[model samples]
Target: MSKNNTKSEGAEEEQPKGKTCFVIMPISDAEGYEPGHFKRVYEYIIKPACTKAGFTPVRADDIKKTNVIVIDILQRLLNSDMAICDLSSRNPNVLYELGVRQAFDMPVSFIKDEVTERIFDIQGFRDIPYNSSLRIDEVNKAVEDISENLKETFKSKGDDINSVIELLGITKAKLPDKVEISAETDLILKSINALSSRLSSLETKNVSFAAPKVVTNAANDISITFNAVDSVGQVVKVSDRVKHFKKGMGTVASIVSVGREIIVSIEFDSGDTGKYTNPVASVIKVINSDN
Candidate 1:
């Protein structure tokens, strides 16, 4: 078998902060030619830990039918907030897929059998240590550590991915009937509509009465930076124009600074007049004082 001579590297995109997890492991030899090990690692170790961390763990072997081979696997990897890989058996398929992710600069967490010496080093990354003994405590600790690491690494890349896709001039896929393959007008229009609905829903809902103090400002055209969330009140951001809003109330005015905390010059309208419950207003709550 032709092994990859070297690993790929790139600047990784920021990860969206969430509890979703993806596991990429070699099913054929994960347990060293043993059947039960696969189930044990995936079910008892991976699944339970992810669930306990409040993450929805996605497994490769659980995929359903698709027109392309492993289409589901690829989809989950791209969609997940974080991913874990088992390099213990040195599975070529797993390594190749890992290479692909590295090509995209995706933040991936790795684990390997303690017995397996480092065949090759991955540039600018670390590996989580594990053993093949199938000890419950060992597996549990590895899983917990990996999950926490993921929470830190890929916590906000969701927006970064969308921005990169847009810069590359590729549109994100949407609902089949709602999406227009060739019509730029229809595609943007639908995206805008979707975004608008999402934003509107967020406005109607109230934050916790004792919600953490967000950005507060004086009535002036001052610089503003804030963390925005999706309709579900999650840290995830939406780019569908309507959801992002533009040209009207609760819309994108112009991005000032677009990293970590989005800095924008928000224009308050007449409706916002005397609505100075808090001045220097923006539609979204401020998550920090850095603005």
Candidate 2:
């Protein structure tokens, strides 16, 4: 009996821990979420916590089922062994899904930004909170708390699984078209296309934001000095003989002096209107203009 028990313990020790932890959170560039906050939580909070607990973390955007988005989400909500729902901003879509998950009375981890007000209905359930201020120390501690809470929840099955309907002795609602793979394809494709369009729009805006700056320079002035290191690594200042690296010839505008960093504001052959800053050690060099 003792030997059989020992063998069973060994088998259990070898068993895999954690599960495919489906993440339900607001995406960046979405309506409620601003540019950087959602990404910070995903990268620093949820993902690290999941990885620490040996779980595979994935968001709705990560799911690429060529089916219906609603159906695909439903399948994930129902089929996933674990879930972490971020209830920040009380997103209608998130709340609807949370309702679906709650009815199942399965292990669902709730979390929200520290600033977000607690949902009245989900007060019965536990929440592992994260701070949006994103102070490194605070975020790290929040990640630790979330990781520990998830581990505890994973082990304590049915301990604090809260479903309002369950408490009220009502039959739990069934998931939408449970595992109806055939009906999901069209919806999924449409969702993917829409997501692609949004992503493209964001990229265009980013490029527009980073465009270069043009400046006025004295046409005949050739007294500009650029600092560089020769083959022997000596400090060498090349003047009068340096042309634009790309344009073969260029004009130097006003050399604005600000602290230790020197910004070479110039107009190149290429017409653009954004100021680009590069490391002086790497970008600044004297090229032979006599050639």
Candidate 2, 181-285: lDDT as tens digits: 455876766778788777766665523222122222456432222322222211112232224444544334434434444345555446532222422322334
In terms of TM-score, which candidate is strongest?
A: 2
Top-scoring candidate (lDDT): 2
Q: Taking the candidates one at a time, how many backbone clashes does each contain?
A: 15, 9
lDDT of 1 at 178: 50
What C-alpha root-mean-square deviation, in Å, does candidate 1 show against the real structure? 22.1
Assess each prediction's global lDDT (C-alpha) against the native.
0.53, 0.62
The sequence of per-residue lDDT tens digits that candidate 1 reaches over residues 115-233 is: 76664545224566765776878877877876665555454344233122333555544424453346886676567667766776667865332221233336533343222233223
Q: Model 2 lDDT vs. the true structure? A: 0.62
lDDT, model 2, position 172: 76
Model 1 alpha-carbon drift over 4 Å, by segment: 1-19, 30-33, 156-291
